[model samples]
Target: MQVLRWDGGGPMLATRDSSTLTVLIGTFAVLWLLWAIKKQRKAAVHPLPPGPRGLPIVGYLPFVGTELHTKFHQLCGIYGPIYKVWLGNKLSIVISSPSLVKEVVRDQDAIFSNRDTNIVGRTITYGGADIALSLNCPNWKMLRKIFVREMLSPTNLDITLALRREEVRKTIRNVYDKKGTHIDLGDLAFITVMNAIMNMLWGGTLRGEEGAKFGAEFKHIFAELVMILGKPNVSDLFPALARFDLQGIRRKAKRISETIDRVLDYAIDKQIKSLAKAKEEGTTKTEQKDFLQVLLELSEQDDGAPSMIMTQIKALVFLS
Candidate 1:
């Protein structure tokens, strides 16, 4: 039968290829197992806090519920105040003890100053360009100095007090006019605080009418942004799959970021044009300079102080 058959060696080639592939796969799996064992041994040398074991690949992701705080509390009860949780491939350590928290926040603050910003957070914050999300470095220190020493100085806060008062009064009047109607106090408080912040940022340039219109639009955008930020993202849990963006969180964040950038650009352009016109007319400016103006002027300074770029300015404006 074998002598009678001549199939051009097709079966033989297929068998050889299959054998080769099997060998390669077997080799890879053995190597992986050895690597895992080595890692476990190394970890044993400096053992981590005890916690529940998880399944392969997915880890404990499947077991976690939507009410994460409650789950964390239960885990704390079982594993003491500090324990590690494997959320997908990421290792998150829970710190529930008050003394441990104080030690991290006060005694070891500098060691833990850098933050691990998620994918969506980084996209919206211009790749961690702002002080809030950026890595702790010289640039971060510089931004903090600008924010605390310059923008939030006692004198600057005093000057912006009128802006805050105006917003509070406006909120109170609005509430009075809508007396007995259903009103969400949370939303009301957020709007009041946001409006005050907006005024303090650019009230010197934007007229009252313009500010009112812009504030409404900005509030809606800001609410959407907060909602997006609060949602748990799969990409954040498994960073290797971030490029795929299975949940589309990154796309939504990018769209919101673009909208905010456009708004900031409009305001910046208007301010630049107004400043130019003032210079051309030789008019003495009498209005209090807003945070935007101060940041711009500082950017132009040739002094030894660490200054900001346009990208940094926009990033700070959005987060501020």
Candidate 2:
């Protein structure tokens, strides 16, 4: 600078900085415009209640903190019964008052029937075929009807009571066997619950070591899946960038999902083969039907379009 030498670096550095500043300014302007448009559209439909505003990219999600209930309590004090919080790109409306909840659930049930699901939710639910994530459509209606009217009806519950009793007795026996020694209460309880649930799902389709291994695998995978789903993924925020999977969330989800799918395949195939053998031998089928048997029967029904399919069956098993 003292000599004002004609070294090429100074002017080029200034030019690069100028270009970077322009790009950042342009990006901010575009973001603001899009946000403004979205606000306008939401206002046009119905003006949302007020809440704390957040940063540019991430919203209130970062500040939600570990004590979510406490944060919610604070927000309720400030924003009253109803308020909206932006979770990254997702807009979540929180209703604190019971009356407002009733108004939304009972009065406007149809409008609120379908809920938004993220990429991991869709991937794990097999594109929303399962009851947990399926859209409110004819298929969903059918699935719900079958689930409630057949699998969870009072009659089915009574029929499956024995299975529950058996699992409880198994736990009791194990505890009795380990009475003199130190026993892991948590492991004991978990295995008992898993056994009971599997019995209700498909009777003995998974039992002993198979049930234990499958439950362990499923539990670990599902925990990871939930974490990935809850974490902020660039792909989820910007749908266009999903194909790139820059964060690799999708790849991890797919790998775990395939492992689950394989387990489901084995269970379904084993059950089908068992049913076929029972039919071939002309043995009287068990009067108490597990959820899987009901699903298989529904899948086989030829009247009025197939109500369920193998994919749907797999999803139901996974959900169970």
What TM-score do all the candidates reach, one by one? 0.82, 0.78
- Candidate 1, residues 1-320, lDDT tens digits: the string is 12233488743224556668999999999999999999999988967797878888778888888999999999999999999989888988889999999988889988887778887779878899998988879999999998998789887787777778888999999999999899999989988888989998887767689877777778888889888899988888888999899988889999988988888888888888877788799984545667887777678789987779888888887789
> In model 1, which regions exceed 4 Å deviation?
1-45, 179-184, 279-286
- The lDDT for every candidate, in the order shown, is 0.84, 0.80
Please report how far candidate 2 places residue 32 from its true position, in Å.
22
**What TM-score number comes out for model 1?**
0.82
| Candidate with best lDDT | 1
Off by over 4 Å in 2: 1-44, 182-187, 207-213, 226-234, 238-241
